[model samples]
Target chain A: MDFIRQVLDRVGDKWSLLVIAALEAGPLRYTDLQRHVPGISQRMLTLTVRQLQQDGLVTRTAYAEVPPRVEYALTSLGRSLHHIVTSLITWVADHHGQIREHRAHTATRP
Target chain B: MDFIRQVLDRVGDKWSLLVIAALEAGPLRYTDLQRHVPGISQRMLTLTVRQLQQDGLVTRTAYAEVPPRVEYALTSLGRSLHHIVTSLITWVADHHGQIREHRAHTATRP
Candidate 1:
């Protein structure tokens, strides 16, 4: 249970989800990752990917080349997580209106 | 995209996930909720429930009786979310060992 909670704490954060979703299509360079996940600061992206790598959900590879080429890609575990993240986004798309309506009604209640 | 991110921010937080999971069994009184989701402070539990209620994911019912009785139950929306949450925990259970091993290896790397 504690382990599950710790994992949740790592994966359930907003930035982590966004980062995971951004990497769903394929591997990306660091700058490309930032571009894919809008509004993420450089520092946050660095930290988020580092944590994902540490968790084995992502892999960072640096190719031997001039100017140093590096890429980030989801491991099998991270790809599995992509399915859940997509479902979550789909759920939000389907029900956000209901939630908004409820919030408005709640705001007006006595 | 922004709306999805905002919704993710609300539902993806650590305490929110724990609170939602705690309510999975059935309706719980405020005190019971606190007890069920270990480590949650009274103030946080109150705030978490209020947010869930506003989102229409939870329904709070107050029964007029001695000292008044209030209970919180998952709405259909919340129940649907429960399925996702369960999947997340299951995923964690399945893969945490891989993550831990990766972390240990990463820690030892030069």
Candidate 2:
């Protein structure tokens, strides 16, 4: 259970999930990843991608080119977790309206 | 997209997910909820439950009795979100070992 909680602490974070989801399309440069997951700050994006790489859910590659390009991509494990991330996003999209209605209703209550 | 991010910020929180999962079996009093989701501070649990209630994902029922019993249970919306929570838990359980291995390997890199 502790191990599960530890892992949850890592991946259950919205930033981590968003970063993982952003890498689903293919490899992305750090800037591309930033654009894909809007509102993520530079520090948080760097930290999130680094953590994902350390967790083996993502990989970071650097090419020894003149410009030295770097890209991040999902490992098989990350891809496996993508469905859950997709479902999470889908769930919010599906229910945010009802949730908003409920919040409004609750606010008007005594 | 902004709405989705806002909802994700709420429900994607680890505390919110843990509290939601803890309430899966049935209604639970505040103290019972604390016990079920280990390591949660009183303040965080209170806040999480309140947010869930306001979002219409949870219901708080107060029974007029000697002790004035209050219980929290998942609304259908919360229940609908339960499977995603379960999947998140299962994903961690399934892959924590690999994650740990990767972390260890990364630590040893030059």
Candidate 3:
């Protein structure tokens, strides 16, 4: 149950899911992840990536160089998560407009 | 893209996913959703449910009965979400242990 809770929490988190989703195309550097996921702050990006790394869903690699370089990528585990989240995304796109109109009509009634 | 972001945000939220996951069994009242999801406060539950309802992921029904009665359930939309979330849960359970140990081992060495 705890495991389910954490997974739900991780997947449920705004930053983490977008981070995972962002990496679907391929590996990205820290800057790339930030740019790819809009509305994400530097702090949130760092925190979420660390959380993902700890969860073993993301792997971070650092390159020893003059300018300093770091990259983040999905492990196989992360890639698998994409399939799950993608399905949810597809479901939402399929249904959200109707749901919104229903709520709008219901709210105006009283 | 906004739809994807909102859907991601909704799913990424802690309370909403659990609330949706809990409802997989059947419909429940507001209080019932609270009980099913441990650690959820009434505020978050109400908020998350409203968000889900707005997103068309959850359907709320009110009965004109003495003392007032209401029940919430997944629209076909919500049920479709169950399929998506279940796959995520499965992925977590399948991999969490190994991931935890990997983090632990790496943590101590560096």
> Highest lDDT: which candidate?
2
Q: Write the per-residue lDDT of candidate 3 for residues B4-100, one digit (tens) a residue.
A: 5666676657677778788999999888888998888788888888888776788889999998999999888778778777676667668777767
Ranking of predictions according to DockQ: 2, 1, 3
Candidate 3 chain A weakest ten by summed lDDT:
A3-12
Candidate DockQ scores, in order:
0.74, 0.75, 0.56
Ten-residue region with minimum lDDT total, candidate 1 chain B = B84-93
Model 1 TM-score (2 dp): 0.92
Give me the candidate number with maximum DockQ: 2
Pick by lDDT: 1 or 3, better one: 1
Off by more than 4 A, model 3: B30-32, B65-68, B106-109
List runs of model 2 lying over 4 Å from the truth.
none
Interface quality of candidate 1 as DockQ: 0.74
* Candidate 2: fraction of native contacts reproduced: 0.86
Instruction: Give the clash total for candidate 3.
Output: 3
Q: What share of the true interface contacts does candidate 1 keep?
A: 0.86
Q: What is the per-residue lDDT of model 2 for residues B14-102, given as tens digits with 9 covering 90 to 100? A: 78989998999999999999999988899999999999999999999999999799999999999999999989988888889999999
How well does each candidate superpose onto the true structure, as a TM-score?
Answer: 0.92, 0.93, 0.81
A-chain TM-score of every model: 0.90, 0.94, 0.87
lDDT of 2 by residue, A1-110 (tens): 77777788889787888898888899999999999998999999999999999999999999999889999999999999999998998899899999999999999999
